[model samples]
Structures are given as structure tokens and as C-alpha cells.
Target: MQLPILAYGHDILRKQCDEIDPSYPGLDKLIDNMWETMYGANGCGLAAPQVNVPVRLFVVDSKSTHDRMDEVIREDHFVREDTGIVETFINANILDESDDAWIDEEGCLSIPALTERVKRPWSITIEYFNRQFEKQTKTFYGTTARMIQHEYDHTEGVLYLDYLKPLTRKLLHGKLEKIAKGQIKAKYPMQFVK
Candidate 1:
């Protein structure tokens, strides 16, 4: 089942998500649904908070992004040969971030119709539990790493909009207000602040 994504004005998106263990109720089902919801919305990543669940859980599939790219674009976009991974991350922690940074346009399932150019590390070393609940540590690079960072920030109560220039955010305030007022149309179901 595809869950309704919570919109920007919702309070849950601003909370620090708690880490979850395998014992968490409906763990497997939630992860599966998240993937469905994400793919249905054409999003490369989805965080639990975006679904109104404030927990250190999220799903990502950068391969979905790669498959859509032209070969020439792919060559310029992917910095790592591995390209990406499709995985469910639980209780994730960023161990280290590479000094190099890249600016990329990103959009969120929760904040529909808004895309921002955000600066993020080109690579990251992280530790997290996989869907099987096995702890794993790995370094991810390029767009894959960018997707992970975006989803990870959601668990930390951060939004890509927060990284925008102050003037840029101010200029977009009116559109943001419309989104918060539930006046925007999205391809998927969304729950907005009342």
C-alpha cells in the first residue's frame, strides 16, 4: 500500500526521528509500503517522517534515477562506477563525509512541486542496519550518496529547503504558503497540516 505523504507544514517533519529495532511493529510492511509510495511518486528516496512516522527509517533507489538518464548524462552524473544501491536503511548514522561537495537539484515527496539546488558531500561513509536487520558500513558516492544524505536529513528534522539561500527562500514564500495550505496538486495522496 502506498502511504499518504505528509506535507511541509506538518509538525512531524520537524522532529528528530527515533531509531528503531527489528521489534518495531509492522517493520517489514512499512518498508515495503515506503518503497511503493516512493516509486509511485517518482521519488528516488523516502523517509519515515515524510510518511508521518518519525523514525530513523527510510528507503532509497538511485538506480531508478540512473535508468532514466541518457548514457551521456549518466557519464557526467555518476562519480562512482558502482552507481547506486536499492536498500532500506534503519537507524542510520553518518560516520564521515568527504570534503568535496556538489550542488544538485533535489525535490521531496513531502514538499511537492518545489526543487532546490542544495550543496552536499560527494561521498559519505555511513553505518546502518539493512532490511534484514544486519549492521553494515559502506561508503557511497555521487548521486547515490546525495540521495542518502537527503533521506538521512529527514530523520534529523532537516529539509532541503533549509539549505536554500535566504533570498531564494523568501522569494518562494508565496508558493510555499500554497503548499502548506494544501492548495497544490500532487500525483500521490498527501496529508497536510490543518
Candidate 2:
């Protein structure tokens, strides 16, 4: 079943998610539904908080252009196809010790009408658990890396706008107010027509 996505200003979206229970009832199914939601919404990533499920879980399915292999590989190392797609991360723990961070434009599923360039790490090595409760380590860089960090922020009750400068925030204040009112919607509407 597709879960109702929490819009901007929803208290749940600002609340930190709880650690997921591997054996919890319907946990796997919930993740599946979230994947559907994310794909249906054309989102690069989706967090439990966005789905109103306050659990430490999120789904990241690589799009054709935002492919993980392209971002994870450099001149030498490579990644296998099976390692991407339908990615599920539970109890995600990110190591933000990297001194290398950059700025880029980002959008959120909940806050749809606007996009902003925010400062974020260009690379990350995150440790998380799959739906089967198996531990996994995934490294990301470039756009994919920025995305991982973006969704990971949701798990911690952080929004992309929070990283914006005060001047930028003021410049977009009107649109942000509309978002806070849930009056704005994504220009490209998302539906499960396929």
C-alpha cells in the first residue's frame, strides 16, 4: 500500500526517526511501499519521516542518470549493477567526519515548489542495514553522494533549507511561507500511472 506522504510543516517531518526493528511486523512490506512511493513521486530518495513513519529507514533507487555506479567509480575502482537499486537502509549511521564538503542545489519531496543550493559533502561512506537486517557499507560521491547526505539529513530532522544562508532564506521567504502552508505543490506531479 502506498503511504500518505507528509507535506512540509508536518510535525513528523521535523522529528528524528526511531531505529527500525528488523523483525517488526510489516517492516519489509513498509519498505516496499516506500519504494513505490519514492518511485511514484520521482524522488531520488525517500525517508521514513517523509512517509510519516518515524523509523530509521529510507529507500534510494538509482535513476538512469543518477546511477550509483557512475558516482561511486573513479578512474580505477568499479561497482556491480546488482549493488544498486531498491536500496533499503535501516538504522543508518553516517560518519560526517569528512573534511571534504561542497555546495549544490537540492529539492525535497515534502517541500516541492522550491529548490536550493546547500553545502554538503561531495562524498560519504555510510553504514546501514538492509531489509533483511544484513549490514552494508555504501560509498557515494558527486550527485549520488550529495543525495545520500540529503536523505540522511531527513533521518536526523534536518531540512535542506536549514543549510541555506540567511540572505537566501529571506530571498525565498515568500515561497517558503507557501510551503509552510502546504499551498504549493510539485510542478511535475507524481502519480502511479505506470
Candidate 3:
């Protein structure tokens, strides 16, 4: 099932998400729905808050991005050689971030049709539970890390727009307002706040 992604103005986007354990009701189903919803929206990542669920969970599939990378670049940067790996992160915490920062344009499912360049660490070490509730710690780099950081921010009640300069944000105010008002058309289904 594909869930309706909540738009930006929704309060749930700004609220910190709660952690869920294995016994949480419909854990498997909810994760499946999120994947369907995210892929439906052509998004590389999606957080629980984007679906109006205040839980520390997000799914990512960076295979397309990975496949497009130059072979040399791929071998040099990515920790995994496999392209199109789907990962589910639950109750994730960033244990460390590299001081090296890079700027990349990012888009969000909740803030449809808007993309912004934000600065973030090039690598991160995170600890989280998988879909099966097994604990794991892993470090990610390059594009994968960038995508993870974006979704991780969602679980922390932060948006990529928040990282923009005040002037940049002001410039986008009109478009954002339109999005909040449900005045813009989105390719995927969305639920705007009334």
C-alpha cells in the first residue's frame, strides 16, 4: 500500500519521532508501505514523519544513483559495490560525522517540487536497528551518506530547508506557501494540512 505523503506545513514534520521496537503494531506492514510510497514518489529516501507517522524509521534505495556513478568513483567512494541495495533504518542515531562537508542539492517528498543545496558531512557513522530489529552500526560515505543525512534529519524534526541561508529561504517563501496551501500539483499523492 502506498501512503499519502504529508506536505511541509504539517506539524508532524516538525515533531521529533518516537522509537519503535520489534513488537510495535504492524511494523512489517508499515515498512512495506513506506517503501511503496517512497518508490511511488521517485524518492531515494523517505522518513516516517513524511507519512504522518512520528516514528524513528526511514527507508533508502540508492541503487540508481549508485549505478550512475563512474566505475572508478564507485570503487573509490562507496563502501559497498552492490548497486540498488534497499535499507531500512529504525531508531537510528548518528554516532559521528566527519568534519569534511560537501554541498549537494536535495529534495524531499514532503516538500514536493522544491530542491535546495545544503551543506553536510561527507561521511557518517550511525547505529540503528534493521527491519528485523537487529542492532547494527555502519558508516556511510558519498551520495549514500548525503541521502541518509537528509532522511535522518526528518526523524529529528529538521528539514533541509532549515539549512538554507535566510535570504534563500525568503526567496522560496512563495513556492513553499503554495505547497502548504496545496496549490501545487505533485506527481504522487499527498496529504496537506487543513
Q: Please list the C-alpha lDDT of all candidates, in the order they appear.
A: 0.91, 0.72, 0.90
Q: What does the lDDT come to for candidate 1?
A: 0.91
Leading candidate by TM-score: 1
**TM-score list, all predictions:** 0.97, 0.82, 0.93
lDDT of 3 by residue, 33-86 (tens): 999999899889999999989999999887877877798877654666446457
Alpha-carbon runs more than 4 Å astray in model 2: 67-86, 187-194
Tell me how far the alpha carbon of residue 119 in candidate 1 is from the true structure, in angstroms, after superposition: 0.8
Candidate 3: residue 108 Cα off by (Å): 0.5
Each prediction's RMSD over C-alphas, in Å, is 0.9, 5.0, 1.9
Q: Tell me which of candidates 1 and 2 scores higher on TM-score.
A: 1
Error of 3 at 12 (Å): 0.3
Between candidates 1 and 3, the one scoring higher on TM-score is 1
Candidate 3 yields a Cα-based lDDT of 0.90
Error of 1 at 52 (Å): 0.9
Q: Write the per-residue lDDT of candidate 2 for residues 1-194, one digit (tens) a residue.
A: 66657767777767888886667778878888898787777777999888877888888764443443454442222123333345778898986435777666688888886788787765678899987899988776665666777788889998898898889879988876676665675544422111
